[model samples]
Target: MICKVAILLVVASVVLASPYNPYYQQQPYAFKYGVQDSYSGQNFGRKEISDGNVVKGTYSVDLPDGRQQTVDYQADKYSGFQAKVSYTGQYH
Candidate 1:
């Protein structure tokens, strides 16, 4: 009887200590790439896609004064790199 009780306690403890949580869902792979510094209020990120001679990517930065900037760029053996940036208001 004591042995059975000890085994039951061990099993219960193992079940309760599991790392899996049902409430949290994993994010998609594309959203996972980025370096963010919450303490400094800054973030930087880039992602790329390529085919043959052409390569394209997106870059983003978060400023310390509550503004964000993003750029979409592309480059090729023939056309060089070109980007367009979008930002909100002036820097404070």
Candidate 2:
């Protein structure tokens, strides 16, 4: 009986906490280097911000073939010079 009750409580808690879980919903924020609302030139870089903190940034690399390589990032203080990329699929 007690075991079943505990299991039920655990399941309830898990369901309730799922929404707040980082895996599901992340807080909306800007980049660290400060991204412009729009980019005009070929080469561009920008920052990411989350909860008023500089989270990460994105930079555009001008390739010799005229194709631009865009990079996105997420914060990782423990990993030296390491960050996660957050790419946007559509502009609209």
**Structural RMSD, model 2:** 12.6
Give the C-alpha miss distance for residue 64 in model 2, angstroms: 2.0
What is the clash tally of candidate 1? Answer: 0
Taken over the whole model, the C-alpha lDDT of each candidate is 0.77, 0.56
Give the true-structure RMSD of model 1. 14.3
Q: Candidate 1, residues 1-92: lDDT per residue as tens digits?
A: 99999999999999889876687554323322788777866688889777545777898888766678889988865789999998875788
Error of 2 at 63 (Å): 1.6
Give the runs in model 1 whose Cα sits over 4 Å from its true position: 1-32, 89-91
TM-score of each: 0.55, 0.33
Residue 2, candidate 2: C-alpha displacement in angstroms: 64
Candidate number achieving the greatest TM-score relative to the actual structure: 1
